[model samples]
Target: MRAADEQDYLDFATARVGALYRSASLLTTGDPHLAEDLVQETLGRMYVHWRHVSVADNPAAYAHTVLVRVFLSHRRRRSSAEQPTGALPEGVATEEDATLRLTLLDALARLGPRDRAVLVLRYWEDRSVEETARALRSSAGAVRTQSSRALGRLRSILGDSLPDLTRS
Candidate 1:
């Protein structure tokens, strides 16, 4: 690649890495290590296609789509099973905030992969139904249906605990 192209790719990656990590973390249900790996894989894939992607109308959206696809692909692999842990590692949050975060992540982790993807893309990333459909290769109707079901599942998972958990 030319120097200018390389510079553009570097600048784009630098600007977007944090957002990518945030999305990945949510998709992975707060697993930082897996989130980092997903981000790295997404960035590497983006770098390979920089010439095509850099000039897209919405490169950040493309990056997010790539991250989600990478995450789903990883989950589909045979070796992707996650082992359970009895305790969470230390995090940089107040006790109450940590509890809330853990509660939410636990609920998210229990969701099916496509349901989780719909929630993250629709709610967390704030994408339109059309946009999410395009990213996930589903029809807009499917996206809407999945999103509604996913939110209902999340509500069921949180149940009455949500009110108590959020009390500050």
Candidate 2:
């Protein structure tokens, strides 16, 4: 690749790495190690396609899509069977209640990979149904259906504790 292209890719990666890592963390249900791995894999893939990606109308969106796809692909691997523990891991700080966050992440961890992906993309990433559909390589109708079902499952998993957990 040309120097200018390499520089552009470096700039883009530097700008977007934090956001990508955040998204990957959510997708991995707060597993920082796996999240870091996912973000690295996403950036590596993006670097390979940076020439085309940098010129896309929405490069950030493309990066997000790549992150989600990489996450889903990782989930499909045979070694993806390990589950997160109920308690949240230490060292990550947030203003939000840690109990609430841990509760939510625990619920998310119980979900199937596609269901978790749908919820994360639709609500966490705040993407449109069509955008999420494109990212997941599914129809908008499927996205909507999966989102609805996933949310219901989350609610079921959380049970009545959700309201209490969210209470300030």
Candidate 3:
């Protein structure tokens, strides 16, 4: 790559890495280690495709799409079957409102990978149905259906305690 192109890629990665990590964290159900790995893989892939990706209309969105796809691919691995634990692992920092965050993340961890992906992309990232569909390589109709179903499942998983947890 030319010096200018390499510089652009570096700048782009620096600007977007934090956002990518945040989305990856959500996708991994707050697993920081896995989230870091996902972001690294996503960035590595983006680096490889920077020449093509740099001219895209929204490179940040492209990065996010890559992060989600990397997450889904990771989930599909046979060795990825191990479930995350309910408690945040030791040394992980928590926000001031840790209980509420933990409750929500724990609920998210219970969901299937695709459902989690839909919810994260549709709501957390605030992507439109079409945008999320493109990211997931799914149809818009499927995205809508999955979004509805996933929200319902999240509600079911949270039950009435969501209100109580948030009230604290």
Candidate 4:
């Protein structure tokens, strides 16, 4: 890419970083540092593949797809154990809802990669089942089925703590 092209990409990446990192953090279970790494890798890969991606399409979505795949594939080659975002700073204490969040995370981590990916794409990214199916190389029926099962599993794991319709 030319110098002007690099500068334009840099501007675009800067503008999208916060949103991308937030998505990454959610996917990474609030691990800011790994989310930062994921964001950086996604940006670098996007920069490399910019020529193939049409300017007419949504670059952010394209980059996000790449980020999610990279994270999933990276996790697949490793163990199921998840690391934290390192110890909190001096004044930071544990979250009041830590147990609940951990329960949810553990449940999510138990899902197969595609299953977990679908939940993130559906609930976290708010993608339609069709969009998620396309992204995950599956049929819409599969996305729907998997998402339903995943939600059932999470609800089972969280039980009463999951939430109540009666609660505000």
Candidate 5:
């Protein structure tokens, strides 16, 4: 274990798993198993590229990118399976804060992958519009348009139940 061979990779994983799972949970609402799978896949990709990433940078952000790519590619390869209520774990199983969390997750799932990524990075990851644009490799103008349109779509999906998104 030389200094350059920094096992800080391991340190980062252990410290960040909770947040990563939370993000994955948001990304894959009804499927805890698939959420774990996506997080694992993202971790693996991150491990392979860890040399280029740094202790100072947000590894979670990089992992978010991997999750978005994996999620989008998975959708392209196979139609999303529809599991009935009986098949999915009860939303009641989620701890306190389930309501808004689940609502946001539903809104996120409704968005197209890139738009979803923008919102997730912007809100969950606490990135600025400029940082988000850089992360998504998009121009600031396009990012604003996409994020605005995405929230608008969420407003439509949730209507009176979620009018607050519309106010933005």
Candidate 6:
């Protein structure tokens, strides 16, 4: 790659890496190591296709789509069934906030990858149904159905604890 092109890619990667990592973290459901690996792979792929990606309408959005695809692909691999266990270390949040966050992440972890992906894209990333359909390579109806079902599953998993957690 030319120096100018390399610089452009670098600039873009630097700006977008944090957001990609955040999305990856949620997709991985608090697995920081796996999230980091996902982001690295996403960035690596973006680098390989930077020529095409840079000129796209929205490179950041493209990068997020790549991240979600990478996550889903990783989940499809047989070896990915081996998940590491442990809670994410606490951040600067208050204890109540930490508890709520962990409860949500734990509930999210119990979901299937596609369900989790739909929830993250629709609710967390605030993507439109059409955008999520494109990201997940599914129809809008499928995305809508998945989103509704995923929320139902999440509510079931959270059960009564969610309201109690929020209140306390």
Q: Largest TM-score belongs to which candidate?
A: 6
Name the regions of candidate 6 deviating beyond 4 angstroms.
79-84, 163-168
Per-candidate TM-scores read 0.90, 0.89, 0.88, 0.79, 0.73, 0.92
lDDT of 4 by residue, 36-153 (tens): 8889998988888776663748887777788888888777766856665443222244574565566666666566666777888898788988988887778999999999998888
CA shift of 108, model 3, Å: 0.5
| 160 Cα displacement, candidate 3 (Å) | 3.1
Better of 1 and 5 by lDDT: 1
What candidate 4 gets wrong by more than 4 Å, as runs, is 79-103, 163-166
For 1-168, candidate 2 gives per-residue lDDT tens digits of 789999999999999998998888788888888888999999999989988998899999899899988888888784748575443555756646677778888888888888888888898789999999999999999999999998898888888766554565
Query: Which candidate number would show the highest lDDT if scored against the true structure?
Result: 6
Local distance difference test, each candidate: 0.88, 0.85, 0.86, 0.76, 0.70, 0.89
Model 4 lDDT at residue 11? 88
lDDT of 6 by residue, 33-124 (tens): 88899999999999999999999999999999999999999988845563756959435898877888899889998888889999989988
**Which ranges in model 5 have alpha carbons more than 4 Å from their true place?**
1-6, 79-99, 162-168
Q: What's the residue-level lDDT of 35 in candidate 2?
A: 88
Q: What is the lDDT of residue 94 in candidate 2?
A: 66
lDDT tens digits, residue span 1-168, model 5: 345545787877777777877776655655678767887887787777787765537666777767767765665676655332223434465453566656666766667767777777787778889987877778889989998998899888877664366587
Descending-lDDT candidate ranking: 6, 1, 3, 2, 4, 5
Displacement of residue 83 (Cα, Å) in model 1 is: 3.9
| TM-score winner, 2 or 4 | 2
By the TM-score metric, which is better: model 1 or model 4?
Answer: 1
Worst 10 residues of 3 by lDDT: 85-94
Clashing pairs in 4: none
